[model samples]
Target chain A: MTTMAERTRTTSGAPGGTRTLTLGKAVNEGLRAAMRRDDKVMLMGEDIGPLGGVFRVTDGLQAEFGEQRVVDTPLAESGIVGTAVGLAMRGYRPVCEIQFDGFVFPAFNQITTQLAKMHNRTRGAVELPVVIRIPYGGGIGAVEHHSESPEALFAHTAGLRVVSPSTPQDAYTMIQEAIACPDPVLFFEPKGRYWAKGEVDLDAEIGSSTLDAARVVRAGTDVTLVAYGPSVETALKTADALAQEGRSAEVIDLRAVSPMDTATVVTSVRRTGRCVVVHEAPVFFGAGAEIAARVTEECFYALEAPVLRVGGFHTPYPVAKHEHDYLPSVDRVLDAVDRAFAH
Target chain B: MTTTNGSNEAIPTLQLLDPEGRRVTTRGTKGYRDRAATLTAEDLRGMYRDMVLTRRFDDEATSLQRQGELALYAPSRGQEAAQVGSAYALRPRDFVFPSYREHGVLQVRGIDTVDRLRFFRGSDHGGWNPYEHNAQVYTVVIGAHALHAVGYAMGVQRDGTPLDAHDGTAVITYFGDGATSQGDVNEAMVYATVNQAPVVFFLQNNQWAISEPTTRQTRTPLYRRGEAFGMPSLRVDGNDVLAVYAATQEALERARRGEGPSFIEAFTYRMGAHTTSDDPTRYRTTDQEEVWRRRDPIDRLAALLRAEKELDDDYVAEVQQSADELGVRLRAGVRALDGGAPVSTFDDVYATPHGVVASERAWYEAYEAGDPPADQYAIAETAQGGAR
Candidate 1:
């Protein structure tokens, strides 16, 4: 195992200048940068102020930005978004922090209705432009509602834009970009990847990352692995493992859950002729469902099997011992991949 | 719009036009209806116009929903007088928080008719702005809108807007009788009272919650419930647009004077189903609807208008025709909703995924070779149908 400092950057990555950043540090930088540039950018959520958030992404922000900007709200999700809506209406760009993924249900109505529709209803009269910062996805050995991958719920809404960044760079850049967007955005930061560190160009404009585009993490010719938010890392590892087994794999990180980068997924499927998507949400209905449907229509002739998905089981996220089973692990991903090839 | 106040010197019940359509002069009163002498005949005519137009839009939107255009529609069929009369009384600066209903109020506030249906149609969450129309989004969660309205009124208090609107800019929240049972509504009253927020808690007691009768929502009358919270409460004949207008106008003025919150329960009936999916016959009776139908606010007002020469048979026909044309525009608007869904990627609950979701998002990418979504049809069909 290499030390954090000794970890190598992806040299064979895209021709663009490569930088290695842990998912956590990227988000931290994104927040710091957003706040540094715009005094209107404020962060508020439980444990976000002096404590730097439960996960510590906003760890040093309070001291740096002061309590007025890095606010620590009570343990109330609805209250947080509700107040933030008020603040935003007052022209303050609030970057709300939701401690856990599943904990977002309490604020679901606020996000889905008020936050999502405010712009359209107002006829763009009010651009909430508020960012709901959430640490989503499964694992972390948590309880019910705490381990949900409920991105589909937000994506199901029309007016709200939902995005998840996979890499440390994406984590950092997307946060700023999300805050800078004119519409309400639910920015899901991969909590597990918080410790993963990489380089972030302090001078880069964070909004450069399109809030609605998909990114291809790795290129392969035989099969395409599609995922987003926290699943990008797993998809990469799975791709590497598949390579050892002589199966070529392409990994696509669907950074935006709504207005899905359907073209990217279809392009890959049209070329590779096989597809396997992975998500941490229950398999019954997740982002994979949307991806599979679109691919079948656009690239039906290219598909050898029905779009295969590796996701959480039908039941609730199980206890720790069975969590590995509940989550779509590398093995499960590959198993699905194997099934796709078998077809 | 005439309000709920004694037009005559002695009687207690509010009056604008008697059932016989004659203007009964109030000998003398300080309330707004008494001040009706200050308004020219044109002001009365304009109020009538707003009430009629709002009803037209409301009826058209309902028909669109019935025709399978909107995902869901909450008809202000019988509550038009309660909503519009109050809305028309307010100045532009006054903010309003409305429950899932209030199609009439939105119209009076100058919100586009088709825009209101964007949410119920499932194409967008809301197509109107709170600031522009001075009305908040149509809150679907019962009684929750009251809290937001109260909070906004608190903001209004903080900003000195309530006290500054000398001409009477105040916050008014419209909710149904059934919503009075929600804890949020109670808490909202508490906040509004304690903070002395310049707000009006307008409860349109539309006598039913889906299939449940008003009796199910309250053991005591909703208007009296406000007195418990130290608010001046009144139960007006909601079917009378004139009464609702006068009462709401007085309340809005009082609020603007920093007089704190007031509760006005517009006693009306849910003439139509709670929503299009509702079958009043299932839990209620058509006979009950028929009884309320004769007391129709529109008819009652039209009868008065005829007696006053404010409207003739030809004018009535013209208004109905104009409403039908407006309905056509609203139908076109509903059809124009964007066909495209949003981006497909995890919005990550917030800015980031908490823990393993990161690796999971990464792992998800590893399992696939091409950009193929898993089950797009299920998402479109299920989510799309929910609003409908």
Candidate 2:
């Protein structure tokens, strides 16, 4: 299932200086741009070179940059990330890719214990400017191990900057920003939205926003719906459906998960007075719990009701046949929104 | 190019000097002796002094830990020859990544005893700058830094440095036999060989991985495992300083020659507990300890020096005097340390400032200053740029 065709041409957006591309292709352009700008940028991952990538996100990178820059590594996840750590220490910006979400655990020790702590452990003598890209969250009809959300695990880590992108423009811009960061960044790509097309300008201004800031995707006043990665679209859809029912739900896309832009989130929650969190990961100890805790403490007086959560059950991501039920959908987000209104 | 027996199978071990301190010229070790002979009597005496001082420092640190002056100590008592010999073969520019027990290696790299002891004294994570000494900080997690070394070597190669040249620009990483079982180590071998990275994997098999013996850690010989990854592998008489030095020198030469990675399994024993927290008596027998004691690296080196008429009473007294001075300085330095600022914890979490960490630091400061619970969150909220 490898595609050899190189689609290098950019498509124009509707009446704007932007281009419409899939989230995966936007990421491909972002990587290409980053490599073009910096000679020190290198890519390493399994099936990322000749085969482009499992999702074709790295299509034609190896051919354009040569195998030295875009390497097709062995099927060892820990090896990929660990080597990236060394390369970073040696003054190279290595952008590593973990093929699947569940496969990231093999490299967890290196990521959490070594890469995350190297800067702090060395007392700021060394900066690990490495970006670990993982295709996370479920909604695609993929089997187990292929689709999962382990963002919370990395977010819980102290030294790592965890972020996820919900749209093509974000996927394109954030990937480049994460690469330039001096600290180690865990960039979670929502695999389910890889094929979702949106407008992203190839020549857009760089560094327009720090990769860690949250954005208000859709504005309303009655209540706020918070989500990231795969769940952001569902929350927006819930807002659209809620508007018909006169609920006027505000949706916040939490692009940065770790040094979480709780300021923006708390600002929206204060205005809306009610909040509902949506996520595909299990609710217990997931990003929802963190958002709920932060909103409660920051907007204690402004909150009209207790925050509600709509997310996957506390179990492993199910088989393809039942994945739709396993993932947080528009109805699920709306149900949580309804619960917040009822309270 | 490690020496092999005539049978077309690799020799299980290469010992240039036997335990009795006599240089051996057997078929398996014959080639290395000539390399070892390049070192003069003065050079050998330096190695002896290094091993002796390192051991004395280790002993004093262990006692300091027991006396509650330090948190804990990983003694490099019996493994000094392995650490010192291999480290002596490296140039100042060659990058070195070490596991926690490479105090001897640190000493060889000119790491100040005070800065090194601060880590064990609970005053610092790793006090010395790695870049300052061409050595990375102590990596406690086993086999993790092997990948770092390989990556660094790969970077060296990418920078257009000729691999085969003796330009004093190679990489060497040290880990224990127990780290062999780690996936990162195995993955590091794969990357090193595939990229033909200019690096050497020095495995100090000190017999025990804490409570487990070398046998429990691996079934076959640890050096042979490197062969499976297509790396040139050899086992050395770790306690024999000359043998280890020769093996490491050859390994470094091979790495510099653009010959990918080399693995040196320094066969030795840990004469003390794994750390200050372990009790060796519960896991090892006295007979086993006695067998390794007869092969003490320092004793064997001392015997070799004495037989050659190089270690006279005056030299012994001078070395003793230096070791005594080292102990006095280490004790005074540790006591003089202020244990650093308590708020320094909020520093270095990220190279760039982070909103979350800043808020948490503010909250911690307010709490430490006896702010009530409500005011602490208010301070954190203000610090994080949240609207109150």
Candidate 3:
């Protein structure tokens, strides 16, 4: 694995210069840029101020901005979100950081019942332009609650736009877009990919149109592999292995889960006729299940076989030693792809 | 004034007017009484009128629910002084976050009568624009908006709204004694005190949460919970309009001065059932009801006005006429309310265009138009766009 410092080389032409940054640093820069752009944009979370958050995703923000802008809040998830709702009502955009995925349950009511429904409940007269950033997914060898993918629970609720970034560049741009968005957004950061380095264009403007749509990361015709967040990297690796096996595979990165770009998946599946949905969430009633149902509905006659899924089983995220088998890996994704072709 | 709890310990409570409607100013009530003294007879009469109108509105809403015009109704009968007085203390620019049962507060805040009934009528979740009246839509989930109030106050502080001036803005959130048990409420106090956010937590300790008594919510006096958070906390007679008004004024002033959040536990009672759906008879006794009936907020305020020579038979008749007119308007407006088109349900669910909502809306529209499932899918596909 390349160290983050080894990836920190900069290109010379652009104003700020295109630089390779870890996903976490990219998000920090994104937040920094957003704060500079709008004084109303503020950061609130536990240890988000002086300590710069546990993951250091918010490092140096409080030093640059004042304590008022980068608030270090009490250790309460519901308080973070609920108060953010108030701030949004008062015309401030508050970006809340939930330290881990599993801990988000404490604020589940605020997110789903209040933050998600405030706008609709008020007939669009009120806009809660708040962003909740949750570091999600496994692979760092952490304990139980620290490593889990709970994206499906939020995506199932209406009045919220749930999105995840698979690459450092996407993380950089999407964070800013999520802040500028007029609706409340749940931004699930793939913690496993925090140190995964990629070149990010520092001067790039946010393209709002692509923020909620799926993108075809790799194109092929033999079969289609759908994945998001951490699993996107796995899907890409699976596609590479398929190519070596003399099989062509298409890879779709589902950036947004709630307002899923299903049409893109449908269009791709029409040509490929084979689909495998992948994620780290439990397969039962997960985001993959929704994608599979939509794909089967749209491309029923065109599909060579039924839509297949590769994901965590319907059980608690197992201990670190067993997480390898529990999480959907390249091998699991490849196996599902091969099964798609078996029919 | 003081009352003994189950433990027989004396608990001080502020009351400007006793149950008999005569002025009573003990050491605990002196400062608050002085604040109430600032109001003229006209101001007192105005407060009385608001309480009367609010009670009349509650009665009408309750009757409407029984007539099947409304799906449910949460009466604000016994807690009129607590709601109206506290709301009266707020400046026009100061924001308010109220629970579902704050009909009197909504009335005092100038929320439209029809809009106030929309939630209970099931025509809309909340029909008023929060920014319009500097008041948020009614929050049904217990204690959730407490955090919002604190957060809004923090925003106000960041916005550089004056803290030491009378013009400085503040935020106040209303909840019941039952809300004290919620984690969000306690978390709100933690945030408010730590951030020193200019907010006031007005607790209408109406003595019950649906069927459960206040004892189930907390062992100590509810105001002590605020004291525990290290803020100025007080208990006031909820039936006395002057006392409630004085307490809220002091709390709001403390907040506007950037002194941080304050808590006021208005010791009131729920003269009516919690809501039209609730059966208070099952858990509470008629004897307890009889004890509180004599302490009705509206009647207490009337007696005060009568003693002060600010009210007469004609004035009472005039207020009653205004309430009767309001009842007529609410009935007409609610029945005439349109829930809007069925397809409009998909509207406003998001601020930006969402593919899922658009797709479902397209399918629904096609289904309504008698299109086949194939045609519906085609329309949905078109609605979501062919590709990114």
Top TM-score prediction, candidate number: 3
Q: Write the per-residue lDDT of candidate 3 for residues A195-227, one digit (tens) a residue.
A: 999999988766567789889999999899999
Give a tens-digit lDDT track for model 2, residues B125-206.
Answer: 8778889999998988889999999999888777777655467478999999899999899999999999988899999988
| Best of the two (1, 2) by DockQ | 2
Worst 10 residues of 2 chain A by lDDT: A1-10
Question: By descending lDDT, how would the candidates be arranged?
Answer: 3, 2, 1
lDDT of 1 at B312: 70
**What is candidate 1's lDDT per residue for A232-322, written digit by digit as tens?**
8899999899889898899999888865767678778889999998988877778888788878877887788889988987887787667
TM-score head-to-head 1 vs 2, winner: 2
lDDT of 2 by residue, A229-307 (tens): 9889999888889989988988999998888888888889889999999988889999889999999988989998899
TM-score of chain B of 2: 0.93
Residue A315 alpha-carbon offset, candidate 2, angstroms: 0.8
For model 1, how does the per-residue alpha-carbon lDDT over B1-388 read when each residue is reduced to its tens digit? 2322212222143556554445555554336456444445566555566667777776777777878887778778887777777776788888878888887888778888777888888865556656666778777778766766765665555454525435655888888877888766776777678666788999888878787777677667678788898988877777766667777777888899988899998877888878877777889878878887877777777677666677776776777776778877877888888634333232323222222223234434434535444654333333322111
Which candidate, 1 or 3, has the higher TM-score?
Answer: 3
Provide C-alpha RMSD values for all models, in order: 10.2, 4.9, 4.4
Please report how far candidate 2 places residue A120 from its true position, in Å. 1.2
